[model samples]
Target: MVRRRLVGAVRSVFNDTARGERPVQPSDEALFAPDTPIRLVHADVTAMMVGGVAALLMQALHPRALQGVLDHSNFREDMLGRLRRTARFIAVTTYAHRDEAEAAIARVDAIHARVTGTMPDGSRYAAQEPGTLAWVHIAESWCFMEAHLRYVRPDMSPADQDRYFAQSGLVARKLGADPVPDTRSEALALIARYRPDLRGSPDARETARIVLAGTSRKPAERALHRLLGEAAVDLLPGFARKMLGLRRPLLTSLPTRAATGMLANTMRWAFGR
Candidate 1:
């Protein structure tokens, strides 16, 4: 049930973008800058917002879904291996720009702190409070989803705009909240009511794949791979085909092992495993 809604939300965001509606962030210019670096940054933001919320909701609602997805014997191991590969790829690509990644991480940490009312090294208070956790998760998801629909969608049609808003309202209703407004200022106002701490933070755009992978159950991981493929074709042109084709086999061979390793390492660090 939640999975289907999640998939629907993903499709709606993409479709909203394709229709040129202000579904996510309300500024198309920010999302489609002509410069390659800027474009990459924009893509990163879109992926982060869309994938982050999706991953969080999935984790909160279906904590065991990832295990189910990975139950295909060798499948899980192969995914884990692929992640390690992808991490290496990110390192190679952004090694020279470590500062940028770190800055982004800092921004995310700050936002997380503000929303959860605890610093990185602080106690996991939110984890213990179900109400706080659910509220934060839903708020984050709504913010990210709204940003994507506004800025990233390609077309500017009335139907698309209506659909985008409708979907946003549906999500809000699902969480027992009122719908967000169509304007950026109004949307921010809504976010502020729930996450007053994050009202003024500069928005950061971490890569979707990386952020989602950090969470326990990420519905968008596989979907993101597919999206990346589409993005490579439409935006990068031939990049995905050449690189992903070569990387796929290695990735496929060790999913479970890699995911388990990551999960184990995280647990060990966070809770002595």
Candidate 2:
């Protein structure tokens, strides 16, 4: 019963029932073949939860992405809502059947179609922009796979890694991103190419700050949230961390990473999946 409660609580973070909404029941379980690597990788609760944080940290580095959030969303109050929607989208696209996936993708695209704004520098920003979409997609895929490798399955084969990236591109393209990278190295290189365009700003820094702070909860759950934040910070690229003034101590870096890994395991045990 304790394990079940722990699992329920973990699931509740992604589930909307706590907010008086129903859990997202699978529309169809035929999205991927039962044996697909993508299914296996994403099914790990620890990696998905940790990597989701890391991906958000990386995404906050992109100026327009951060600006879009500031200009468009009531992010502070509805933070969990935002996370639940993203998780729901990923779950549907990755595990639901083709029709459900397409519907989810189309719903997101329709929402994106309506989000438009001008940045502080008087540059136009649109949620539908291919570049922005690609950044979000790649950041998510990169962090997710990284967490999977680090905490869940260190020995994941290179071929499977490539397959995961290439396979993830399908969802990216469906979301209207052009030039989605279909290989591991290419995805990293694509992020590199965008370095000149990525910048640290007040908005970006604040986004990172709020995301890391997490929500109020009981002692054990609050501790889990704190550990996830530290793990996310650990997973961030060195320059990215510096950009947001999130520099960790050099002496404690090794121990911190080890602790974060252990916490991830504990989270998974609590998840009981």
Candidate 3:
């Protein structure tokens, strides 16, 4: 009974019961094959949450992407809601039937079509822009892999890692991301190419704060959220941390990593993974 309740609570956090999202059962016709790296990596709830936060920070560093969020999304007010929607998207795309995954992609594409706006510097920005979408995809895939490696599979093979990128690239292509990276080297090179376009605007920093601070009212939940946020920040590249004016987890790195690993293990156990 206790284990069942714990599982239900975790699922509720990720599944958004109010919106009719439940756990996605992996389908024989899912986008990726069963036991694939993408499936294994994305299965750990704790790692994905940490990685998702890190990815959001990385994505906000791009002025156009930040502008889109500021002008269109209620990220400031409904951060958890936004995160749940993203989690749902990943679950659907990764584990649902191919038709459902394609429909999910179509829904995102339609939303992107409407997410255009002008940046603060009088430049037009569209969420559907292929280059911008590529950055988003790269940041998310890289961070997710980083978190998975750190918390779940430190020795995941190079071939499997490459396969993960290749698998995720299919979704990126469907979403109109140009030049999606299908290997670790390609992802690094793509990030390098976009370095000049990244920035730490005021809006981005504020959003980062909101994301890391989290919205949990319960003290225990808040403490766990802080631990996850710190771990996520520690996973970022030094350049990204510097641009965002976020400090490295220097004195607390060991404890933070240890605590996060424990939490990851506990979550995995709770979910019977």
Best by lDDT: 3
| Clashing residue pairs found in predicted model 2 | none
Q: Top TM-score: which candidate number?
A: 3
Quote the RMSD, in angstroms, for model 3: 0.9
Per-residue lDDT of candidate 3, residues 210-240 (tens digit): 9998888999889988998999999998899
When summed lDDT is taken over every stretch of 10 residues in candidate 3, the lowest stretch is 13-22
Query: Sorted by TM-score, highest first, which candidate order results?
Result: 3, 2, 1
2 or 3, which is superior by lDDT? 3
- Which sections of candidate 2 miss by over 4 Å? 18-29, 267-273
lDDT: worst 10-residue window of model 2: 21-30
Better candidate number, 2 or 3, judged by TM-score: 3
What is the clash count for each candidate, in the order shown?
Answer: 32, 0, 0
Predicted candidate 1 versus true structure: per-residue lDDT over 1-273, tens digit per residue: 654564455434333345453323213332122333222322343433333333332222221222222232232235444333323322222332434444544443343343333333354332223344334444444434433443343343545444433433432333334444444345445444543222111111112233233432466666654443332222211221232222334444355334433432332344221
Better of 1 and 3 by TM-score: 3
